[model samples]
Target: MKIAVTSKAFAKNETLKSELQSFFPDCRFNTSGRLLNESELIEFLGDCDGAIVAMEQIQAPVLDDVNLLKVIAKFGVGLNNIDLSYCQKNGIPVKWTAGINRQSVAEMALGFMLMLIRNLYTTSNQLKKGEWNKSGGQSLYGKTIGIIGMGHIGQELTHLLKPFACRVLANDVVDINEFCEKNGVVSVGKETIYAEADIISLHTPLNTSTVQFIDATAFHKMTKKPIFINTARGELVNLQDLHDALLNGQLYGAAIDVYDVEPPTHKELISMPNLVCTPHIGGNSAEATLAMGRSAISHLVDSLLGAANER
Candidate 1:
């Protein structure tokens, strides 16, 4: 079977490449070192029987053009990029495993909280610029931490925070009262979390309701002026509001792992002294990358090859 791997990072991994080849030698990998556009993606996926993809949008148009494509296995957790309704309508199988890199992202969120609270990021940058400032920020111990989503990554982060003895206030659309009770978390409304917490972290998925969820209004409700962190989807927060919040002292600090635009060009926002940013590497840890790649490959193998063998 002809297979296409659209994730540039996963394509370049020799370990994953060899493992995939053992199952299906007729595989194509995107070695362009960048994300492919629609035309490029169509050409790359042409006539392939199965595919393992990451971040690339696979809507109805792409699916229509790539008629030979049978099954798709996702390399990461987010499904906002894929048109699930279209895939289901066409009887195409999309295999995806959530929380495959839960620990990696959870760790990064915790790191962001520590960095912002302790003023590690700002101090490090100041030192690099030949400025001496000895402002050691506050500790994470016994602080009120507000977690906006109680999904896989959020749950993992809750577990990680146990050692710090933090007061965790959680908010979710679904019923998580049982989990909150068991974990000593206070399941409260988002507004209560916004008003009371010392630190706020977002882990919700991007959907219609959650798009631009954190705006000026949300920031205004943050009475404690807590440090804010977003390791989840970028579209969930308004970048302009975030920038304004930091500039106007509405927030203590902010840390961003993802952005509305990858390689974000908002110089003013990125250059803020009270903010720390990464190139969306929360789930790209060495261990997480390998695990995510293997899971995708396994899903494709099981769907395409293992099923045929069973038949």
Candidate 2:
């Protein structure tokens, strides 16, 4: 059967193609530059029986057009990019690689927390410029870290933070009381987290209700002038509010990997020295990429072989 691996990043990492080919030698893969629009996607999938999608939206419109489309195996766990209910209704099975990069993402968040607390970026720059001035900074030892969303990533992050002996405040929409009790993470309300956290990290999924959860009011209410770390969905925090807070000294600093808009055409926050930005590479390490690719391919293989009985 014909297959299409439609991803902007997949074009660079040719290993996935090799791995898939090894398992299903007869399957043909057509590489597209990126996720295609409705009309473009229809044309691109021409005779493809299955597809590997990354960040593209597979709405009902595109799914309706693909007469031959079967499985839509996503590289990562976020299904918000695709329309799940529509896919289910149409019987076009969709599967996503789950928790493959949990440790990698958690590590990146921990690194960001340390960097932001110590002003490492600024200090490194100053020292390189022949200034040996000692810059006082905050320590992670006793800080209260509020982890919003206690999923795989959040749990891994909690493990990392535990070594530092920092107070962990973990909150989840679902019942993660077992994890909280075992890890000594205090499960609390959203208001308490927003108000008391020394450093706040967001790990929640991007959905209607939680979108822009951290807005101007939330930022204004933070009494600690907390350093914000966001490695998850960017839109969860208001970009305008963040920019305004940094300018007005309401926030200490911010380490952001994701953005409200990807490849932000005009991010005003980039101009602020206190704002450390990365182009959404929290889980883009080589190890993590290979893990996601191999895991997704394995899931597809199992599903096709009628071995995904438990799933």
Candidate 3:
């Protein structure tokens, strides 16, 4: 079996290369960075059984080009970057690495929440300009926090928030009754969570229904001015709604780590002062990167080594 790795723009693929070698010794591995066209990716993935991928588009267009492609062991849980339904329909399994970087993502969420509430970014800029203003920060100890998705990352975030003694409200599609009970968090509907939470953090994935899940109407529904935070998919929150919320006093502030676009080719939402933006580095921590890489590669070997099993 030949294993080909399509590299990310600024990501390190060393661990993925080593892990693939460990599983299939006879497999040929080639690392590439410039796959501008679908034909180019097809040429690289020529006879490969499975490929470890990150943030690359594996649509039917690129998928059509590859002949022996079987498994796409994506390095993370989010499948928004790929055409997952098309892959599923064509029997090309898109295996994901889950529960590997939960702690990293949870910690980043906590940091952003605290930063937004305290206005840390603004304070730093003010000090740099030689201004002395003693601003007060709100307490998270007794405030309410709404977590959008109560998955592994959401549960992990609750663990970190517990030290702050926050009342946690969780919203998810499935029955999280037992999960919420064990974690000292209460499960509620999405509308109720949006209306009552002092701080709202998103832990959901990007899907058709969830895209723009928190739009203008959702922002308008938030009764209390919230310290909004989104560490999940960026498309979940409509940028204009958020901008209006900030402009019209509907929101206190926001901390964003992800965007609808990667590397941000667009310029509308990111330039806002109230929103603290990072370079989508939520899962780029040293430990998290290695864990995701190792876990994804392991899944690839399990499903794709023998005969390029689709699932």
Candidate 4:
């Protein structure tokens, strides 16, 4: 069987490559180190029987063109980029493993919070420019932390924050009452979180209900003017609205790891002193990369070899 590995990180890993080759023998990796556009991606997967993909959009058009493709095993947790309905309609099974990088993403979110509240980011920048600034900011201890989408990453972050003695306000569409009660997380409404939280972090998936969920109107609801952090999907926040909020002092500041566009082109927004931006490396830790790759490989091997029940 022929298989294509579309994730650059997974493709570059010698261990993962060898492991996949052991099962399939004929495995193609994206070695060019360039993010493939839609046409290029379709062409690359033309002769493959199955693929392990990350971040690439797999919609009806791409699926319709690739007649030989049988299955897709997602390299990461997020499935917003893939059209699940289309895949289901066409009988193409999309195998996925969730929460593989939960701790990695949670740690990044915690780092962002500490950097913003402690004034570490701005002070570091000032020092680099030969300016001495020693202004201290608020402490994370005894602060109200609002967490949206109390899933794996959110739960992990809550656990990490336990030593800090912060109040965790959690909100999720589905019931997480037992877990919240156990962790001392208060189940609250979105409005309450906006008004009360000292720090707000997003951990939700980007779906119809969540795309552009944090817009100008949401910013307007911020009575506390909290420090915002997003380690989740890029489209979850409106970049323009966030920029306006930072400029207008709607919130203290923001640290965003994901953007509407990867390697975002908006210089004005990204260059803001109060805002911190990263190149979507929240789940790219060495350990998380290995775990996610192995999980994707497991799904692919299980699905194709008729061991789906084991998975």
The candidate that achieves the highest lDDT relative to the unseen native structure = 1
How are the candidates ranked when ordered by TM-score, highest leading?
1, 4, 2, 3
All candidates' TM-scores? 0.98, 0.92, 0.89, 0.97
- Which digits, one per residue and each the tens of the lDDT, describe model 1 over residues 1-311? 99999998898899999999999999899998887888887888888999999988888778878888889999989999888999999989999899999999999999999998998988999999999989999999999999999999999999999999999999999999999999999999999999999999999999999999999999999999999999999899999999999999999999998889887878899999999899989999999999999999999988999989999
- lDDT per residue (tens digit) for residues 196-256 in model 3: 9999999898887898988889888889989889888888888778777887888888888
Candidate 2 lDDT, 1-311, residue by residue in tens? 66677766654677877888776665544355444677877777657777777777678788778888778888766788888998888888888766778888999999989988987976776789998858858888989999999999999999999879999988899999999999899999878887899999889999998899889999988888998889988889888888999999998888888887777644678778788888888887888888877777876777664543565
**Could you tell me which 10 consecutive residues in candidate 1 have the lowest summed lDDT?**
55-64
Global lDDT for candidate 4? 0.91
lDDT of each: 0.93, 0.82, 0.79, 0.91
Clashing pairs in 3: none
How much is the lDDT of residue 18 in candidate 2? Answer: 84
Model 1's alpha-carbon lDDT is 0.93
Q: Give the lowest summed-lDDT range of ten residues in model 4.
A: 302-311
Clashes of each: 0, 0, 0, 0
Poorly placed runs, candidate 1 (over 4 Å)? none
lDDT at position 140, candidate 2? 85
In the order shown, what is each candidate's alpha-carbon RMSD? 0.9, 2.7, 3.0, 1.9
Arrange candidates, best lDDT first: 1, 4, 2, 3
lDDT, candidate 4, 1-311, per-residue tens: 89998899899899889988888899989887866788978898989989999988888788888888889999879998888998898888998888999999999999999999999999999999999999878899999999999999999999999999999999999999999989899999988899999999999999999999999999989888999999998899999999999999999999999988877977899999999899999999999998998988888887786654455
Higher-ranked by TM-score: 1 or 4 = 1
Error of 4 at 111 (Å): 0.3
Range of the 10 consecutive residues with the lowest summed lDDT in candidate 2: 26-35
